[model samples]
Every structure is written in structure tokens, then in C-alpha cells.
Target: MKSLKLMALATLFSTGLHAQDRVKGFVYHDVNNNGRRDGKETGISKVAVSNGVQVTLTDEKGWYELPVGKDNGIFVIKPRGYKVPLNRDNLPKFYYLHKPQGSPATLEFKGVKPTGPLPESVDFALLPQQETDDYTALIFGDPQPYTARELEFFEKGIIREVAGIKGVAFGLSLGDLVGNDLNLHQPYIKAVKKIGLPWYNLIGNHDMNFDVKTDSLSDETYEANFGPANYAFNYGKVHYIILDDVLYPNPRSGKGYLGGFRKDQLDFVENDLKFVDKDKLVVLAFHIPLEHRNGDTFRSEDRQRLFDLLKDFPNTLSLSAHMHTQSQIFYGTAEGWRQEQPHHEYNAGTTSGDWYSGQLNEQGVPAATMRDGTPKGYAFIHFKGSQYVIDYKVAGKDKSYQIEVFHPKVVGHGKNTRAGIYANFFMGHQTNLVECRIDDGKWQKMTPVSAADPAYLAELHPWDTSEELLAGRRPTNATDSPHLWRTAIATDLPIGTHSIEVRAKDRYGRIHTQKSTYRIEKAKEL
Candidate 1:
């Protein structure tokens, strides 16, 4: 238990000292809720532990040994039916930082200080908790607040609606927890904790320490706030892996950052999966999308390596949020995926939509609708066994308000309409079945178009073309909305109010129906 001299593991390895070669650990049941193993406390068997890359399971006596080849982290993966201790920020403290020499000294944000020496017996304690296969997790993306005022706007605009929400097992924010201002980390945590659930966070590109010269030290502040930037945990039948995939000081550009993973991260995935069941749903959550419109933002080799690691796992899904837009991207054989079933990556919609722009609504919060016409909202991923379905919830709106139907409110009597009816199914994909019907008539298939959402354009127009200054900033110009569907309707129907109903079946086979009323009137009345 004595502290060894402060020395990097690499230096010691070169000098032929193998003090840090192996990590011996015990996974014990914390009967009294204490974090230490007592005389009567029993060790838990078959528990998985890891040294970042290599994974090992506890023996019958709850003992495990993982080889720590270099300066690597050692942590326990919380098994199902067991709960790890949580820190003050409600973050699960299931891992211990193993940087003997600590982080590099020059980084602006401080990382873990020198821990001196490896412990004789590194132990993990867990309390028992009952979990259900059918549970929902609250998912938020890019709650990136820049200032205290913007933080307040985030609280009032998004968090206000889901405060103290029930029926959710836990919550996850898909990175970009704060804007460039790292000081807002605590404030962001304070606001999100109001939901009263265990929360996990992914380190975003904006969350990195830009002052750091290399990508390895980029996450010092993030790691200081949240535990390990990359770690894994289990709940019910699912194994959730949270990774820090942002590589700062872009290797190609030598500035800013790139979206990808390090070799150790891929190795961690390979090692961790060794102990996981093939049938269990493996979920990976991170910040940058694997593929961006500008092309593949992440390195192709890293993605291929990840896909290779996930080849055996039949049920897997990755969640990302950086584009500030909501869309579903599937990677198949063309993307180097080995399995016949393509990997599904959900590029989540941001809570801070369009950098929190647009005019303020009656609630005094910015409209902040994303450029794609998707509202500033969060999502709920419902999981049952190894299968899952996602539902996006627009802040301050009812759950049933899933589709935004755009059409003219009125049309001239007996005249053919030039404008077509557009439906922006916020959680839709091209493969989804989108159809529209008029006044109980037969449904007509809607065409998928890669065009801007007219509704979002209309939302931005009032501010863009304003004669006077508006209360809030103008929203960004509309971009191609991937989820938009359109179908033309004839205004030749008799003069009266008509209902246009839109029906969509998502990839998961969940059907959603929404209707809007449009009127036909005489020319004189118009």
C-alpha cells in the first residue's frame, strides 16, 4: 500500500522494472453499502474487469488479473443486477484512472495528478439493483451552452419540460455537454440532474481542451469532470460503451480536430467484447458522426476496426451527435461492415438546435428548431431484451406531435394546387414508409426528397426578412432535410375544410399518424 516514486510506466519498463505488469482485483458485494471489502463481505464471481485493452473475468473466488502493459486504465464493468457507486454529479464511478506519471504537465486543463503507485489489491464494490429488460433511457445531444444566459435558456427551453420525469431508467447526453466555456460544466450538470436519474456523458469536440498540443491530452478537463472519457457499463441485457472518439489537432490538418478513435480504443472494444454475450445488444455512444455530409469525418480504418470487433454481435447500434441535425445513417458492406445486417447509427438531434438561434416563442425561449426542421428535442430509446426502438420528444410538445405537416392553409375553390404537401417526420429515414391521404381517401405514397424543410424556411424567413430587429437571433438557413417527404394534392375538391392525414411506418415498424386541416374557399372570399 506504500506509494512508489513518481515514474511513468514506460520509463520503468525500459529500466526492466515490472512492478506495474499485472493488476489483481476483487469484485465484492458491498452489503453495508460501504466501498471496501469487510470480513463478512463476499466476493462476486464471474464479474468482468479490464485494463482498458485486456478484459478478464473474476474466478470462483471473485479474483481477476489483467495485464497492464503500459500506462493504462483499470476499471470494472458494472454487471447486470449490480449498481456501481455514483459521484456527486450522478456519474457512475466504476473505474480508476491508472496514469502513474499522470497527464502531461503543459495542458491548460489539469488531468489526474500522479497516483504514485499501483495498489496491492485494486477492488470494486457494487450494490445489488433490480433492472428490467423493458426500460427507457433519456437521450439528449449537444446541450452546448456557451454562457450563463444560454445555460438558463437551456434550462428553461429543454430541461424544463422533462424535469422530474418518470419511467426512465437512466439518461445520456451524446457529448457537447457545454460549449467552449469549460466553466459551464458544473452548471450543465446542475440543470440536467433535475431529471433525477443516473446520467452518463460523452466527451464532445467542443468539450476538449484546445490548449493541449496533442490529441491524447485534449480531454484532460473532460476526464477531470467526467470519469474516463471511454468506458463501458451494463444494464439489463445491454452493454453500453461510451467512447471519446474526437482526435484533436487533426492529424491531416494539424489543427482543430478529427472524428475517430485511437488504437487503444479499438483494442478496448475487442477486449471488452470477449466477455460479452453475442446475443446482448451492444450500444456505442459518442459525439462525432461516423459519416458526415462532407464525407466520412472519422478515419475509415478505425471504423473498419470497430466494425470488425462488432462482427459477431448481431444486435448493435451506435449513437452520435455533432452535425446538429437529426438523421439515421446505416453502414453496410460498402462501408466495410462484415455482417449481412448493416450497422445503424443514429445521428441525434441537438438540444441546442442551430446554436440556440431563432426568434423567441411565448415561453421566452428561442425556437431553436434545427436546420432540418427537426425541433430542438431529446430522444427516448426504448429497449426490450436485445431489441430497441427510439422515440424523439420535442421539448414543450406532446409526444404524439411527431410529424410536422406543411401545406397551404387555404386554396382557391376548384383550382389545382401548385404547392405540394410536405411531411417532416422528425425521426424518419428514407427506408421508412411515408404516405398521405386526403379526407378519408385512399393513401398515396410520398416521394423522398433531399430538399430543405419549407416549414424551417418559413420559421427563418420572418427573422431574415424582418424590417425591424427581432427579440432573438435569426435561425441558420435551411439545409437539405433528410427526413422530408412530399406528395401533391389537388385543390379541386368542393369548397370546404379538408383533412390531410399523414401516416409513416419507421424502420422499427412503429406506425405514426398525424393530420392537418386545409381549407378550400371561393375566390371572392379569399
Candidate 2:
């Protein structure tokens, strides 16, 4: 009888511990913006809340309960027609970090301080806002500033142009907000706040705490500054899923990091999407591109699992940025896309192109052209209902300047030469049609070629051949440009300067045109 009583007591203790692991929260409206559930304030019904993996919706009373682990973040997904409050740095405050033991002391950077016990009620407050299906969002890829000086360049070269601008809803940086230095996170936040918009951020490989051994602990510093590394929010008619897809300490090699998602993140996505309307547009934002030229950079199984989870959604787009170069990739049935229309992934250009390398410009900033011949720039995504159109805005230039043409200033008249006219359409794709004409001559189709951009080569040549060292660091070596078009120049033209016009039809059926001049000099007597 004594042993039976001891066994029953032990079982009772284990059950009580399990009950303590669950947490409850309320999603309420803060009418006075004081961030408290006042007596008059009412709870919002049907609000979705998550505990990193599992998702649950609030009842009619705006109360929700979910099981929480030792290290997890509880967040409320901001639904449409409502807005989350922003902190002093303009970062959305929608998550509560729960770390019972805090971060390990071996970490190089600081992480979240320990929270002794779960709160009696962990509530989230949201304010009302007017949102519509038609809206615009500013997207920036990799504004990675390694040092204080480079951060200055970012502030002057990128932020100064769009500060306090009108007509945009909000903005987000893909990742690598600061280069390896965790200390620069504050400076980057201060600089980006100048834009006067609520900003969201992703945790890149560089943003991790490399001193940690496991991937789960790598984002300690990032989480300390930003909110949950994986979370979702609704804007207008679009559902944005921000993810930290970088797997640190490489699961395979146990040394470096790789591009992939963890099992818990995938579970969260799968559970979160269950409540989303199928007609809504789904946008996934992360740091590294799913498709890499160097071969199999992302884990194949993880991608397949993600695809399976997203198969039912017909309209979906993904954005990534670690490459610095810009390109549009399509994943068809061969790549496990289940929909008829292939999935589109935009590998956006970096604000810090080629790691802020190249010669100094008139503005005292590095030209910083990308290796794929794309200029350092940002993208504006305009969404109408379920459709979105992205426009790339090159810094220090007018918005209309979309194409860069390169050709010899003068060519021999009536003498066949190997010189070719090359046009680098910044947003061109393989399926897009590009044509060129000279002096109102017949329009000829330009062949798309995977080759180096001659214009970028011209920028890089001076650094190599100059007797004295250039002012700024040398640009990275050229790579094959995916959006470049070329056609042989006709040397049989008249002996005068001729105007050449190049027109490109983008994937969205929008036409962009640019013009240049080339002179045909009469061949001298031999």
C-alpha cells in the first residue's frame, strides 16, 4: 500500500508540471493607446496567436491559450484593418520572448534576459487603421554596413533619398541589416527610422551569434534587437510571412551556415496557413535565395516540404537577397510547384552593392555596382488585391532610368567590325521581348545572352589599369548577367551620329524604352 501511494504521487506531480507549461493571453484593443486592457476596452474576436509552432485563434472573448516551451516567442499576427504599435525605433511590437534561463554566457553578444515565470496574462494590444486592397510597400535587400563609416554611406546614399516620402504603406529590409558587428544594430535602426515608416527585419546569416553551437542559439543577438525571427502579419489583402531561413553551423558540415528552414518554423507556417483565405496573396520574405548558381545551396527536403504546404495557394511570391545581384527566378512543375503558373522568386538587388565596393562618385559614395551589372537599388511592390507589380528604383538616378546601353562611341563606316550593341535591362527576364532600332531603321530582335555587362566592365577596367590606386575598393569580378541583351551593330550606316532606341517588354507586359547615340566615322585611306 505504501509503494502504490508513492507511484500515484509521482504521476500527480508530472501532470501538474505539464499544466504549468501552458500560457493564456488576450488580444484586446487599446483605445487610448496606453497598451493596457482597461475595463471599457473589449477583446478582439478571432485573432490568431502563435507560440512559435502551434497556432490558435481567440474566442469570442478575445482570449487564447497555447502550450509554450522553455525557449519560445509568443506573437499575435496583425490582421487587416488593424495595426500593431511601434517602439521608439519604429519596429513593430507584436511578440513576447520567453526564455526561462536566458541565453548562454558563452555567446559573444548579449541576448534576451531571463523571464523567471510565465505571466498571469500575456496580452497584445492593437490599434485600428484604414487598410485597402490596393497599397504599396518599399522593399530593400541587404543594407549591410560592416563599420561605422560604411553605415554613414548607407545613411547618405540610400536613406536620404526616401526619407519621409509619401504614398508608401510600410517598408522592410530583407536581412544583413549590419555586417558581422552586432553593435551596429542600434545605428542601423536609428538610420532606417528616418524613413518614418514601420519597418520589419529578417535575421541573416551574418546577423547570427557565431559563437553558439546550435542553429537555435545562433539568433540570440538578433532576437534581442528585433522581435521573433519567424512571424506573420496581414497587410491589405496580402499575408506576409517573414522567416529566418538561414541554418547556422551548417547541419551537414557542422561549421558554416546554409540556406534552409527548421522543422519548427515549417510547422508554424503549415499551421498558420490553415486559417488564411485561399484567395489572399501570400508573400514569403527571407535572406538567401532559394535558387543559387553555385548549385544546391538550400536543403532540398525543406524546400519540398514548404512547397507541399503552399501547394493549394495559387497566388504566391517569394523575395530573397543575399546574392547582392538582382534576378527573377521561376520554379515550375519540375521544381515541385503544383500550380499551373510557375512560382516567381525575386532575388532583389542590395542597397550595399558588392559590399559597398567600387570607385567614388560625385556624391562621395561608392558606385557599388553589382557583379551581375545591376546598379545598387531598392524595389517598390504595388499590390492590387491578389496581384503585385515590382519596380526597381536605382539610387542617385531618376526613376525612369531603367536600362543601361553600351556601345562604341564611333565605328568605321562600310567596314565590318566585331563590336556589338549591348543593353542591360535592369528588370529583364528570359521570356521578355527586347528589340532595338537605329536611325528609324527596321526593328530587330535582340538576343538574350548570359554574359558580362560591358558597361560594368568599363567601370571595373579603370581600377585594374590605373597606375595609381583608386579611391574606393575594386568592384567584384563580373558574373554572367541574366537580364542582358545583345545584337551586332550595323557598320554599313551613314557617316553621321545615329540615334539608337532599345525597347523591352517586361514580364508584366509593361514596355520600357531607352535611347543612345553611336557615330559612324568614314574609314581612312589605308
Candidate 3:
């Protein structure tokens, strides 16, 4: 009889714990100098309450429920306008930041330093949601500044417009805060902080401090000041994922300047995917693009593994930077796996707007995209719950960007006969396409040539205004470097003269076109 009673008592205790499996918290807007949510203070209604994933509006009384893991469910999303208090590391004190911070010497992820009174009631104050016909997260590609003057170029060009975002909820940078100088992050962050919205930062190839040992280069301070380095947050209806694409301690260079991810972060991504609804959109963002440099640069082994994890999900948007121009393409069947197009990618342009090139606009901004004739801008994405649309918004320019086009330079009638077709878009990134058309026929795509190829890399314009480089961001030493642009040779050619025109288009429907005329005289008898 005693043993039975003990067993029964244990069962009841287990059930009780299960009953409280979730962490319970109440949200209140900070109103009238009071931290508590009072009765009808004209606040809290329509306020969004999220456990960091599924979001629900607060009831008339600011009542909300957050489902958290039995053990780690202490975090609540900090409402906009009112920010959570910062801890010693400047991290928000509330909203469940898992780890704790002991000392600056310690790693940043011991989890957040717990919370204050009102354990169950975590209130948030919002500045009233700003509604627009659309919303966007402007992505800047590699704004790799070789010097402080280049930083000025960044500010004078791209920063001016980004600093003045009107209806933007937030902006996300795809890494490369500096050109191999980790020291620049502080000033870079300060400059970008002027944007006024909650901007998320990512680590890039150039941002690494090579002097530090690989283990110590974990970017602890980055997470300390910028929150979780590998974290997912909900904004509007979309789930934004900012990943550390550049794995440090790279083997190729014996340094951390290249690309790839650590297994730990990849695993984190796997776990994060489980938190959201497959039907909803998943935006995968990183610095190195999946398809770059003649389709070689990407986090494939890991990316494919991740691609498999996300393939089952209904909709996904993958965004990247690193390459300093604009290029975009689709991938996968949106269902089963195809070996060919496993994933889609959109490489963003530099926010320094052509590395601060060209003359200044009226707003005191420089001509960032002066070379390709493209304007400095970030992407504009709009989401209605789950469904969404992406557009290109060139900063300072009144018009939204659409894809431009050029016809392939083909010598003959068949495949592989393509002579040459190069795209010269500057600071152009986003969901766009560099499609081509032959003799005004069906539009075809011109594959992005490599900036690594001696011929092409030489032509690729660097935004950094180094005095040594000549026209088009290339070095004036090209004539002697042996890497200067090489003459292109097309294998197949017909016996007649031909003319071709090509066109380019982005998701925003922006367009650019190019045409060339060539003659192929009858070949002499061999």
C-alpha cells in the first residue's frame, strides 16, 4: 500500500510539471512611466506577441501566451520602439537570450543574463506598426573598404540613402564590414547605426582579424554587441535567417578569408528549420553565395545538406553577398530535388554604393553604381502573412530597378556557338536575372563570368578608389600583369555576317539592354 501511494504521487507530480511545460509570460506596454500594463491605457491592443516564431496579437487587455521549451522558454520578443534593457555586453536583458555573460573575457553565449520581476508578465511597448504597400530588407553586398577613405566613399554613397529609410522595418547587411581589418567594425557599425531601424550584421571574408588565433576569432564581441551571431528573428510575416557563411581558419589560405560554415552553425540551421511552419516562407541569408565564380563558390556540402533540410519546406528565399555586383537566379523544383538547379541565389550589391564612386547626388550621396550605370540600392521585399513579393529599390533614384538585357554573341546557329556575352551591372544584386536574347529571338541567360579569370577579374571594377587602379575598378598595372582582359574566341561560326542584341531583367522587372554587330566572312579553303 505504501509503494502504490509513492508511485501515484510521482505520477501526479509528473503530470503537474507537464501541465506547466510552457513558460508563461504577460506583455504590457511601458506606458505613463509605469512598467505594468494597466487598464485601457490606449496601448497594447493590436500589439504583436511572439515566442520568436508564431506571432499573435495581444487581446484587448494586452494578454498573450508564449509557448517555450520546457527548459529554455524564458525569451519573449522585444516589441519595437521599446527596446529591452542592455546587459553588461549591451545585449537586451529580456526576451530569452539563452546564454549568460560573465565577463568580457568569456564567450558571449552563456545565454542571456535572465530577467527581472513580472517573470510571467513580459510587457512590450511598440511605436505603432508602420504600414506600407510593401516592406523590404535592403541587402548590401561586399562593401570591402581597403581604407578609411573608402569608408567615406561608403558613407557618401550608399549610407546616405540607407540612413534615411522611411518605411523600412529593418535592414540586413550580408557581411564584409571591412577589408581584412576587424578594427573597422566599430566605425562601420556606428555608420550603419544611423539607418535608425534594427539592422542585423553578418561576418564576411574581409572582416576577419587575421592576427587573432582561429579559436579566439569567434567574433564574441560581434555577438555581444549585435545579439546572436547565428539567430533567427521574426519580422512581419517572414522568418529572417542571418548565417555565418564564412567559416574561419580556412585551410586554403591558412587564414579565414574564404567561405564555408562550421558544422555547429549548420546544425543550428537544421534545428531552426524545425521551429517554423513549412508553408510559411523561410529566408536563408548569408555572405557567400551558393553559385559564384562560374558556379564554384558556395557552402554546398553544408548547403546541400541544409538544402535537403529545407527542400521539404514549401517556400524559401536564399540571399547572399560577397560578390560586389548584382546577379540572381532560381533553383530547385519547389518540390523534389533536381541535381541541376539545387538552389536559387541572389547576390546583393555593395551598400557603399560602388564603394563610394562617382559624383555626389543632391542628397550628398555619391554615384555608387557609376560603372554599370546601375544605382545604389537595397532590395524591397513585401510579405502578407506568408505570400510575398521582392523588388529592387535603387537608393536616391525615384524608379524601382528592372532587369536589363543583352543578346548573346553567337557566331553560328547551334548550342555552344555562343561567342561571348558579358554582363556589366554594378552594385546590382537581388532577385534579378541577366537574361540574353539572340537576334531578337527568345531571351537566354548569360552566365556570370568569373572575377577570378585573369581576363574577367581584371575588368571587374573594384569600388575601393585605390590610386593604383585605372578605369573600371581594375588595376592600371593590368598591361604588365599578364592578367589583363584577354581576347575572347568563339569556336563555331557561320559564313555570313550577324547582329545580336541582349536584354537583362530582375525580379523587379527592371531592364538593361546591349547590342553588338559582327561580320563573319566566308572562310578560305583549308
Candidate 1 regions off by >4 Å? 1-21, 69-71, 292-296, 524-526
Q: Flag regions of model 2 displaced more than 4 Å.
A: 1-20, 292-295
Q: In terms of lDDT, which candidate is strongest?
A: 2
Encode model 1's per-residue lDDT on 154-226: one tens digit a residue: 9998888888899998999999999988888888988988878889898999898898777767887776677
**lDDT sort, best first:** 2, 1, 3
Clashes (backbone N, CA, C under 3 Å), per candidate, total 0, 0, 38
Using TM-score, give the best candidate's number. Answer: 2
Q: Which model is ahead, 1 or 3, in terms of lDDT?
A: 1
Worst 10 residues of 1 by lDDT: 1-10
Which parts of model 3 have CA positions greater than 4 angstroms off?
A: 1-134, 209-217, 251-254, 292-299, 333-342, 353-377, 384-388, 393-526
User: Per-candidate TM vs. native?
Assistant: 0.93, 0.96, 0.59
Which of the two candidates, 2 or 3, achieves a greater lDDT against the reference?
Answer: 2
